[model samples]
Target: MHTPTTTPSPVPPTNPAALLRAMFDAAVAAAQPARCLPPHLPAAPAKGRLIVIGAGKASAEMAQVAEAHYRRQGVAVEGLVITRYGHGAPCEHVEIVEASHPVPDNAGLVAAQRLRKRVTGLSADDVVVALISGGGSALLVAPDEGLTLDDKQAVHRALLASGAGIGEMNLVRRHLSALKGGRLAALCHPATVHTLLISDVPGDDPIDIASGPTVADPTTCADALATLARYRIALPDAVMARLRSGAAESVKPGDVRLAGHTCTTVAAPRASLEAAAEVARAAGITPWVLGDDLEGEARAMGTTLAGLARQTARHGHPFAAPCVLLSGGESTVTLPTDAAAAANLGRGGRNVEFLLSLGVALNSEPGVWALAADTDGIDGLEPIAGAVLHPDTLVRAWAAGLNPRTCLDRHDGHGFFQAIGDSVVTGPTLTNVNDFRAILITARP
Candidate 1:
């Protein structure tokens, strides 16, 4: 006699919110370091030490996974990894240090200095595995000569508000950082370096993610200066002088010191999007993955996507009803130009800003619902990830005595969502593959 077997049921299509969240959870789960990093980890060195050094929001988790993978093989490892505050994990072999992210602090400076020292004086027999992911650019803070932590922080603050894309921001950051733009890899000369990356930037450019600490940069100092000028971002006189004098140039590509280094992208935005699409398909919802490298101003992208959703809802030109439109990429929020507005700007990140803008443009369109959140779980500086939108979102805002338009104008997506009790909070997901967005358009009654 054979026992009966049953397949797990797909999420009910009626619960659009739960289904969207499940897709997001599935996407994040797909990029986990435990699942992606081990396959890419290099073999242990036969005669010398296996040193692991890394920095990023996911670095600690990656280090822990790497340590466990090797330990199971009877290979002992020792190293250090730096992660954002509250993102550390317990590990015996690799020391995990917590520091500030999206802005550098004293803790990050000390950690960066120590991390650089750890890789110096290594020989050919030594193997260095760099666990790099998003947020390392700030967590691995090593300012160049004549630059202080305050200077670095100022640059980060300015760039965060400059509406610059990740690639553009990192282009400038590579010049100011001591460990970025492949200098960290240069320091590991003679040692075979294996870099495992979880990409969070569009196009999955290794150099843009975490400013490419272990990857050689092809951009020049002149390019960095051009970016600052394009954004009209001001810096201290000393910082300006450093860039002007070409003193902040990074290690260029093809540098012999960087030879024999290997880089592998363990997880990427495209794979995560595909994972989410699979969930949507299983639920009897047709999934349309728009693309994974979308980029633009947050609100602007929101408006554009709203048009697509409206088109699908009204005419079914692009896709039929009961379908999800999914996309992944980093978006920017250029701060308000007015002084008072800038001073009182409300809390939220690009994902929230995008969602709020989409909700407003949607104008409570029937049978339309959406969710947008950062994969890492923290949107902007706040603990909130992002927000969800329903056909009645604006109606509920009006009922709550909150003006969604005013909130969006002030860049206060968090304020609007929180007041409506619609903010999605998923603190410290420990992995970042940039932003996740899904719009579910059900059949109109």
Candidate 2:
């Protein structure tokens, strides 16, 4: 492992950006497949043509590295993977297609259907390298028969607006998908399916990523229906019927359909968090990782974390101010007001909104700067991953003549942060391991 240079600038027992950055870097490095993919895959099968296929935020990049590794051994493979727009990697052999995410559009529908046909004729000796990641559930949308692309698109819109958790939304997605819930693996059955997964789900469950299209599902149709109901999301008549008809059950694990399968998590949020922690330690600052699989209301989570960070700075309850706090996981945003009904609403993902709320709660405490971002480098539909929040973030917003409360009330963190020039844009990191967060708390130097 390459160690970072340590500058003896005595970090005052209070402020901690350097330490936080180290932990964030470690987490990102841990989830990077460029360092993890080559060794896990078996040699290409002898009797059948190697076929690669997958869908996710990282599928395109995973495919590229997987293909490169095999080709380096003088092996050739042909396949296709669908990734979110602008998430494509440079590919020589495998075809990479970009599509809409969080919702299935015409492009995703076509790409997914095409992927289905590409793997339909595989034989026992053939090998299929399936790359699955966080956004695959929506990106690989092949709704069952009689369901139009619009139908799936409608349900996706509802799910997004519903603030349904990842697990809930994915359960509905698997039921709606023709290629999810092990249907893809079933199609590729008799052909050994080796999956390279970069887990974005809370627990890194293969079945949760992309709705387990290429892995056995542990969720059932009832669970999908219950999730939709729990959120009070109104599904279209056709979608509700599809659920009630009982024809959309996902294949459970231990099913014979997956007798010759393997799903390996080459990377995940935990790996990224640990990686970032190592960076902090090397920087001569202590790192206290809160957790990697945190999930809850974004604003609430922000308040909770901000309190801990403040406590760390003051009481040293969790850790001293000289240490950094890091964590990873997906957070939810429940539409609180009637703003969506009143207007087009604002920009920014859950992470950005969380920071906005946190900044307001922190109230410009000195010597603190924090960054929170989605590792995929895209937050919501925006090209920006997330943003940073310094003690002066709110002050700067006011200086720019922006109303922070109004923005937060309207769920417009992107607009507010952008006005303050705090938005962090790192387009398409070519990987997804959920959200990565670093909070630095330090005393006055």
Candidate 3:
């Protein structure tokens, strides 16, 4: 009589934790600013004054690359790049401004204003290189003329909880700001604009990053109004007036003002995800890349993936044992009721939530280990991007008095994983390629 093993049939490398870490690190290496920011970069036009303005998690490094490119090309450059706090990179010619993320703050407001100022007063003789990446929407916060920081923060917080996709979130953002939705490009009207982007949005739409600060947006004010309504996010009275009054739409394609401008994608999630798949293949594990543009709610997404992994374990239909599952994309979480200031509210981002949900579904199935993380090194607002869970996770959690199902119900995966010391913390990677997820499946016979 054979004893039934709790995991999939064909065992992979005994240490799946190491396998997950390797894949994640490979993904990050492919996306590091130093690697991804160079090619899309062009030689600064000869005899043109170089001006750089940017916003995003990777904007600082993007700025660094721009400065370096122009410097090597003998083009003198002066500019400012705003990124989330701790995402700053040092550049001699460019100012790197650190700001708040997911939520706008005073620091970001000031930085956005200063970035606008940097592009202002420019002439046709000037060349403005806009360096952009993910997370810029919050980093590039500059309320229109009369709006206060408080007002912008309130609106942003509401939209985040609204379950809106990046496109919808940015649509509203473009209407309410001075720097987003190509308004920044408008400010540098006479100057020749060149936007070098590191896309974090699915489908790689330049206009979606940081609400496309320098990219044209065909989305109109009416569309913005509809998005807010669809999300049921209430806006301040001033914002309402701006919308009712027909604010300028972001730069649209074919607009002559943008004909002279150029936008290039320097790096993307697909590139990073592919790189990771290669790492897994090199390790002798076959890799199935679901995609790099995945997006959806945290828990539901996990449930779907959990089902797939289990199928591979039970039937090996899509893939055999000794395989790894790979995917990349940004996932959102709707914070649960903060009532009671829930002390056990787990402390992680979508990755943690996904893992917790996976743990519940997997039910401590032995032999399979997995990891999830934000490639930027931070997961949600927490320092840990994600953690690894083994088949015995259920046993371990119960021993620690953590009910995996209870944690999942409360959206407190972060808190639960923290208690287990399973959270993977890699502070401030300075680049965001969205999120990286990998599951290692080994066969048990």
Number of colliding residue pairs in each model: 0, 13, 14
Question: What is the TM-score of candidate 2?
Answer: 0.94
Better of 1 and 3 by TM-score: 1
Error of 1 at 393 (Å): 1.1
lDDT of model 2 at position 206 = 80
lDDT value, residue 28 of candidate 1: 94
Better of 2 and 3 by TM-score: 2
**Model 1, position 371: C-alpha lDDT score:** 95
Which of candidates 1 and 3 is the stronger one according to lDDT? 1
TM-scores of all models?
A: 0.96, 0.94, 0.93
Give the 10-residue window scoring lowest on summed lDDT in candidate 2.
1-10
- Tens digits of per-residue lDDT for model 2 on 1-445? 1222333233653334444444545565667668877778777898788988889988888888988898888998899999988889888999999999877788998898899899887888899888888898888989886688889988888887787778888888888889998999999878899888889988888877878888888787788888888888887899998898888887778988789788898887877876776666666566666777888888888888888777766677656556667777788887643665447578868889888888887888776678888888888788887888887888888888988878887788889888888787776778888998888766522
Candidate 1: segments with Cα more than 4 A from true spot: 1-12
What are the Cα lDDT values of the candidates?
0.90, 0.80, 0.80
Error of 3 at 7 (Å): 22
Off by over 4 Å in 2: 1-10, 13-26, 336-344
